[model samples]
Target: MNKWLTIVLCIGLPLAVGGVSAYVTVQNIQNWYPGLAKPFFNPPNTVFGPVWTALYILMGVSFYLLLREPSSEKKKQAILLFFIQLVLNFWWSILFFRFHWIGIAFIDIVLLWLFIILMIRQFYRVSGKAANLQWPYLAWVSFANVLNAAIWYLNH
Candidate 1:
């Protein structure tokens, strides 16, 4: 396969998933989300789209770099961890925005954060650059966890 095509496919996977998640999020933003009690530190709705897009792109690049490594048990583990976290990532929008399950969403984000940590560790074993690429993602998710917690607290 062409290297460029491979890169696009890798990046597209996350972006495509993000698109679906964004769809779920958009559905709520106009009707449901505006009603929620958010933290003072919460960013405007405009901020989320660009932030998430950049993070997903970075995540795709990290996964692409990880995929360049030779197949090994560690690589396989890292791949599994990536997918697990991605699924968790998708579920967060549903839990928080669609279902309005803020408390459960907080729990999901915590588990997602842990899985991202494990994924980054495994990515390091495969490719340092790949692991490095995930830092911003981890940071954003960390902030998201705090935001989720605060929203839960404020509402409940």
Candidate 2:
């Protein structure tokens, strides 16, 4: 594959995954169980879309930077971790929205948060720029984890 295409794929594929996850999350929010109570700090529903869109784009850029690196065993491991986190990323939305399992979603996001940290560390080893690009994503996921925990706590 062409190098540019590989970069595009690295970015675009994750963006596509994030898009699907966002769609499912929105749909689920609209259909959320009526009795469940949200926390006081829960932002209005309007905030999620734009916030996630930016995060997903940042995530793609981070991955694209990593792809620009010369191939190596470490690069390969980083790429593997990248995909693993992406899969976990999508599953968080599914667990929270589709399955309506708040506790499970909390568990999933905690795991996702750890994977994101590992990915960032690995990305840093390959390309400092790539790892730096991931900081915003890490911050967002950290906030999301707190939100997820609050949701689980309040709803239960």
The best candidate in terms of TM-score: 1
lDDT of 1 at 103: 92
C-alpha lDDT (0 to 100) for residue 29 of candidate 2:
76
Give the runs in model 1 whose Cα sits over 4 Å from its true position: none
Each model's TM-score, in the order given? 0.98, 0.91
What would you estimate as the lDDT of candidate 2? 0.85
lDDT of 1: 0.94
Per-model RMSD to reference = 0.7, 1.7
Which pairs, if any, clash in model 1?
none
Candidate 1, residues 1-156, lDDT tens digits: the string is 788998998899999998998787787877998898889999999999899999999999999999989999999999999999999999999889989999999999999999999999999999999999999999999999999999999999
Q: Rate the local accuracy (lDDT) of all candidates.
A: 0.94, 0.85
Q: Report the C-alpha displacement of residue 31, candidate 1, in angstroms.
A: 1.1
134 Cα displacement, candidate 2 (Å): 0.7
lDDT of 1 at 143: 97
